[model samples]
Target: MSNIKEDQANFTNGFYLETHKRWEKFSNWIHCICVVTFDLELGQALESIYPPHVTLTKQETLNICYLAFPDSNSGCMGDTNFIVRLQSCPSKAVLSNVHTAYNSKCPPALQINPAYYWGYVYFRQVKDIKLPRGYFQKSVVILSRLPFNNLFTKIISVIAPEYFDNGNLSLEAACYNIDQWPTPVPGLTLSLPLLGSVFQTFIPHQRNSTSLILQLAGLNEVATSSENQIQASVEDLNLFDIFQPVLSHIDMLWELVITAEPLIVMASSPNHCSLMVLALTRIISPLKFCADHRTYFTIHDSDFKQFTNKVHGTPPVILGVTNPFFAKTLHHWPHTVRLGEDYGQYQKYKLKKNGNSKIFDSTPGVYSSYKPFLQKDKTMIKNLISGINTKRPFEVQSALLKKHLLELTHSFMIPLERYIASLMPLLKNISPFRAAPTPLPFNPDDFFAMLETAGPQLTTGIKGDWVGLYKKFFRSPNFNGWFNNRYTELALKLQALQLQALSDADLKLWVQGKPEVEIVDMVLKIKNKIKKCEQHDIPVSHTIKEQLEQRLQDIISSLPDDLKNILQTS
Candidate 1:
């Protein structure tokens, strides 16, 4: 049977109203999310089949990811992206987009043709948590579950579907971030790895549409991000602020794809790579970690799992209490106990302080239980979590990840540069006088006419971005002079052949032996060329005509003195 479950987040049984109201209380605006990706690598064999765009940066792909469950649909999920600078244009310096899945159906318009700002998104296969459907039935909680395979397929399909096809999706989540926090603390945190997908759909602006298309074409692999941890705490203790960092970990996912057929053709036409950078931002999950000590931590599913294990040994003694004293004693005491809700679950308990115990109302909202660990262990765990969550200490972890990403980017560029260097020789040795399969009678007028029609195509071969490549090649200090020299040699040879053929045809020598049928075929081909030129906005062919004639005259003058004098006399 298919494991796919109907998305519960889509309001079906009036459940959406309940969940929406819950998050509404904590909702904060003005969210800022950033994605930085570098060190992009393409398959060596694939590069030969479909060459990478040389006009843009190579190390420009990376992944970002986050976790999700019952409460949040567009919650913090992991995402992957590539960061690059435009070659010629200024102003917009970067391009960033995040990929994520949602339980609710998108708008009808967005499903087929998503808005330009929506970035790129695809439908993710989903399933229900079979047991959890009953577990939280007594309470207002609902936990949704979907397998990693479904998530992985959706992610890779958005990127280059042809290469990463049928990839195995494997992911594991631990109760705690082993690297940062080895032991269990009073608070909860989760560590999970997320799959990265490509964002291919982009708005059709002249600047970004072309470069983005080419960049995504060569992109095959989906980026898998490093494990990110989300920490949640509910401590009323003032001493906690001194020990822990301000934030535990910020999980953000960004996915974007560039798609525009017409723009791709236009931007890549000229010698200059129509290079422009674009930066766009969308709020995946906007959560502001409280900078003050009064802030309470909220745990997600991943973190709750770890918290469950730490208290698994100790049974919770459920008690009904309305007084602050009951909760205070529970806080001061040890052993896992639940006052109202279960421990290690995504429940935020309100800590209200009051001095009078006689007026203490016996309500189940306050939890009391025996402590699980020794006093020393408890202190250590609390201090470690606190220190990591602090602003300065958390930044250290973020910085380390950033540095690692940059190193990967540098490594990717080395092989890419080598590949481009290898192509220099082939580009230089292009033969201008190479004969076609069918040789037609030589006519200078026809040659010039074809040149006028195929102005850009004559220099740019099929499947090659020659003009963009040439501009980029000239900027390279190592190959600039050599490329110019080889290009000059090829241009001059082609010009000479055209001029010589024209001179011979005028003198009635070049086609003297050719039959009348051959001449007619050449005339037909020339007419078709002219027709094609009229179809589009033709560049100034007259300018090229003048240059061709001037070059022909210069070549004749440079000829040997005896030949030149004979030609002049004739």
Candidate 2:
């Protein structure tokens, strides 16, 4: 116990020289870097700082420490990496995909405006006999608003172990190399650099890899990013990786994730726990589940009360929790998936529903609530099985599963995407003679009619009474958000055209036979339209503003003596 007290006070700072890279550049890639280590005699302590001179506030240091050492028990299997998000005050760092992840009914945690934020950590432990404990525990943490999952993980892999053996000098060199990297843009393959090694990754387009709803409507509302890139991809996010633990019920799980049901994924380790959660979230790519989810949650996480206590609030719609304690604690959660390590049972999982622990305690087997609505591709499953038996490279198997899932997702979105486009008012329909047209009101019945007629052709690979799924999604925040954006975009287009025709071709001619008061009203109306344009970030037409101003002046000069005095005073 005295040694434990001694361990508690043990901490070491790394030594390094400053790099030539600009300070602000370092910040854009990552907010700050932290290194934490555990002395067997002690618990966890902050060991070093990357930008060595600065000191952290108590709040910041405590937050990092909490996230740094998340595991409740002692178990180290080589090295593991995972992600954590800290509850923070609203910051300026909002990522486009993170924004899209929030559906209108998003949990209060996500709805809070605290912008993009996260902590990507790499934990490693090495045996040390000279200490109070047999092993020395250490972890490297990066605090950043960016969710460059692969990129950050790669950065840690290069820096952490080397810093462990060497010191701050090695860490500084790695940071310098990273500082030279370019800003992330969606849809382009970026060649990232770190310590003389380069890694290439293609940032998936948000439209292709994340929810369809990409923009937020309403000015002074949560702003949406124009970049097409969704969040950074994890190395493994395909069905093979996510559902590998329960391949038999792959289709059913897909339905569950798409519907954004409350789910708990149990795993043996924090890294596996976090990876599974990230993969599940992305597997329903391009559909955007829009539910609040934590990649990895420990029993000690700050939100424990919010999750377990129904009196305060309900739990997140989706969660990935570690620690067997959750077995009893969250037994009441709607769905729980307990995982096994060996590849054999990776396909088998404990799935509990309706708060039934008997079901929870029951032996692992296929737990299908009902047959999947989407037609299953038996051939694909056989190939996956064959690949596993033949021991095919994991990448090849994961790729095949990914392609199939994307095909299914695209199939689901196509008819709806096509139908949504049809609702836009025709360009020819715009006229100064009338007010801007409203988007054709969405009629689910009409869409269903079209599906009945052409659904088979549009979704050749997937056949089902997905009408239920689609209807369920209609009540979700994602669908509402998508429709709202489409409506706003189309409405703005209609107004733009009307403004164009009125400024160059309609105003002068339409006012020819109108009264002075009516002309004044017309000018005021166009002015209001310009204001809306500015609010939505649509380019305002100077031609219209100038023409309307000229018209207003003409009316004022021509007004009768009595009316002129009244107008001037008003």
Candidate 3:
């Protein structure tokens, strides 16, 4: 029995060692294939297989090999130009026959166990091929997989929320690939997410959030710069005075995802490694600290939380009136208080003053002089008056008022913060609101209507003004004056239309008066204008037309129920 137990132990140990050895061999094989393959097939195949104990069928293995070593795009494999030549007594016919047989038997794709495969293949056409050993070696390193096992898999599951519940197939395959190449490649960082990691995690979702964050950060940076410039220019001509409607452009990125959950999942996934890196870089970047104080201070969540805490603790108290005698005493005392004499003098003075006051009238004239003596202090006065009028303690009234004021302030702040945050990305497109030459409230609808009526005449007028200004100041050529004027005029007009469409009253009125019918008529008019413009070879901008169409849509969206019903009819 003892001998049998010992044998059993020996057998188990040997089996474990052999398994390890097999995995090592497989890793080597995969590395070699990666080096030899010209295409992404092998890597993709490895990615498709689940990890750990993953075993590909014979067919699957062949398919993987074929994909890895595609004959097309020889440049990817190596820069060596080579020609194939058959030597020996074998007839051309015989060589052709052999080649055909080899090709027929070869699988469309090839797969090999990353752990056990160690063989290498050399591609030789009938000619001399010049291959770089270093390049081949680098490719091999890239293709090799990292060592992953059950233990590693468990660790990954715990660390990466996306992969926790998934099966071990992907992990096993990744481990096998890792075993193929034990050494890391130069210039290749380990931080890159493996293909398996991408599959298991929602990377795509995180990408969107990261993009938005980056965009916001960029806008904030621009706004900060502009604000700084404005501050610096304050001593000079009011920065706002010389400001013009700078033509600004904003790039709006739109993605149509079916659901929000997937977006959230992607944002939360491990695949957002790039986003994490970006966030870290931004946090550590020295330039971020140099930004405007408000912007720099606002970016941090902790600072806002601290401010809120401080404001919450201290409540604002109002100052008011109490007793006439005490008030007089408080007012007359020359920075010092005397007890009996001063107090009596103060009372007499208060009685004379109280004769004319309504508050003293409430009490009998004789006792009015004996009015309650309360020390005159802003807070004390406020408290006494509030208590007398409200019939409540000063502290309670102040606390309640402070709480209400804070709430109102907070209500205003939340939306402002959100808007400011949103504006960060759009800062580049928004011209600074100038205070010096008070900015004219540019009505978009009115502007567009004028443009439609005036066309190039209005554009020319703007250009003439700019040209006159340019000649007066710099005496320099204004080559772009005409183009800039035309574009600006058109843009302002379109802006006006967009603003009008956003008006709730106009939308409601339009909808009630048969918006659908109006829309159809408008579409027809636009189509005809577009056709005529094309026919006449007129340089009408399509962008203006598109904006007009969008305004129609906005109007439709904002239509009231009664108007909507009218539109629905017929």
Candidate 4:
């Protein structure tokens, strides 16, 4: 009788799970949340895998733990958060479409197209005296392709600390809340509530914003940021803490970032490694860095063979590694930054090249350094030192450094931005008949010549051979990305101008002398114009689209009875 009852209970439980468990899948922006904790007998181990049904290979779990934990002298030293950017070979289902509030009654879209999953992992750790070793070390990792570190970290920031004291209940609740969020469509800023706190994320409609920022809405705040306001990121990238140690060498580093040089940053721990990598990637603002960079990388990652092959040398990857093994392997690379403990020290890098292999027994300090085009402000350095001596809050000290860097980057970019504007054709050249007016040619010679007359050195407050700097920069990936974006933006603007003019003019006037075939072709072009504007998310395009669409129908209606059938076919 007991056996029969047990079988009956099992059947009921299985039936409910099969029908009602769809809601328990991973979050939309998040792939999976995992708990990697220290096991007494097994050492580092994965304590729990969320969703209860997901399976991970033994090797994958081991690597997750290795990446989740920081390699420092004092293990589980303090509560901290850092990203672990890894290349993973996940199962097909793991990389499925983003989860929504799953409805069992509703069939999912028949297509099961698997998107490539890039692991944007959030690692958090804490300690508890009540645990086995007086140190409760664990990492809560969320795997996803979205590089919205500022957003996801905030969620894990709450979830991890709570889970350390409480248990899986908080984690489950947060996951449930995230799973219910809207599809995160572009141009929408959704106010997501997780465990009583409100967070905001702006899925930008266009490429106007360079980064994704998650804002935590304070309940007692007098007001919230208006939805229209687009702030790049609420959290400062990596804080000012990383820049203080290498204040003197900052100018050279900025040059390296802009030039897209392959550099390695080896630090004592994962926190410093990841933080420094993030900070370096953002030094040049307005002009986004185009090179590949890893925030935190380990030897056990799937990309290990790709990154470490001696025959290939090193690709142009700005890597942040904690393993000392990279010292020998990557010695052949162009530049290597050796960061001291707590990021307290840094050294200039130089390369002694012999067919791009480590030919000489030299310390990692041999990269070609460039002098700053703009003079360094000694006063700020003095103030920073004074702050450190007087025990100023890290926030205050960091802000000062960030301000200086921001100013420095802007000064460098002003000359470029000004020169780029001069490349645009005059407004009088634009016409309604053309699909889009092209910008004037980007002649390197003309630009260099204009720099002198443009008062570039004076306008930018950057002294030196401005021409030489431009020559070097124009060849770089950083400059390429900026130049492309500038031209593309200008082109889109021209397209919009043409559409705007078309909206005002009578379509019948333009089509009077045109053939039916020509009119049909014109209609197709107009359709494409609307689609392009929609893709680019031009605010005025919607109005113009309706106008063009209506005018097309009117032209068709006015056509003679014979051509009307042909127009209808079109």
- Model 4, runs deviating above 4 Å: 1-28, 37-66, 71-80, 87-138, 146-151, 164-169, 182-191, 196-234, 310-313, 344-375, 386-393, 536-539, 562-570
1-570 per-residue lDDT for model 2 (tens digits): 232223222211222334323544555456678998875454677888765554666555666676676566526556878887665544343533323333223321123233435778888776879766777678898876655556677678777877777666566666555555665554455665655556555444443333222211011112233343222232334446556767656666677777666677766666666766776766666555566677777665666767887565444366766666776777666566666655233455544344454344634333334445676777777788888889887666776776666677667777887788788788788876568787798999988888876664565665667888788768766577557766776777777777666555544456676897886676557656667766654444776667655654555556677776765465
Please, what are the lDDT tens digits per residue for candidate 4 over residues 1-570?
233244334434543465334433334556677888778898768888655556666766777777777764425366767776654554544433332212111111111113333333444444567887876677778765555556666777776776666677666666655655666454455666656566765543334332222121111212355544223332345445677666666766777787777888877677677778877876765456776677777776667788878697767678988777776777667676666654543332343332234333334433433454445556767777788778887766765666566666666677677877877777777776775678876788877676666645563454565566667788877777678867877777777777888777788887888887877777777767777766655546467788977876767766788877876675
State every prediction's TM-score relative to the real structure: 0.19, 0.73, 0.16, 0.74
| Highest TM-score scorer | 4
What does candidate 3 score in Cα RMSD to the true structure?
Answer: 33.3
What Cα-based lDDT does every candidate model obtain? 0.23, 0.61, 0.26, 0.62
Which ranges of candidate 2 are over 4 A from the true structure?
1-22, 39-63, 91-116, 130-134, 206-238, 311-316, 343-355, 358-375, 390-393, 426-429, 432-443, 461-464, 495-570
Clashing pairs in 4: 349-365, 349-366, 349-367, 350-365, 350-366, 350-367, 351-366
**Candidate 4 Cα deviation (angstroms), residue 549:** 2.4
- Write the residue-wise lDDT of candidate 1 on 1-570 in tens digits: 011112121213333345433222111100111111111242111111001111212311111111101113222122211111111112213221211111112211111111111111111213326543222110000011111112222332332222223211110000001112211111112222222211221111122222222222222222333233211111111112211111111010010100000000001111011111110111010110001100011122122232224344311211112223333333322211122312222232332232233134333222222111111223333444444556344334333333322232223223323333333333223332232112122333443344344433433222233233323323433133233433443444443444333323332232346564554444333333334334321222654445444433444454457755654454
**Candidate 1, position 124, lDDT:** 25
Judge candidate 2 at residue 152 and give its lDDT: 74
In model 3, what is the error at residue 504, expressed in angstroms? 55
Model 1, residue 555: what's the lDDT? 40
TM-score of 2: 0.73
* 2 against 3, candidate with superior TM-score: 2
| Superior by lDDT: candidate 1 or candidate 3 | 3
Clash tally, candidates in order: 41, 7, 49, 7
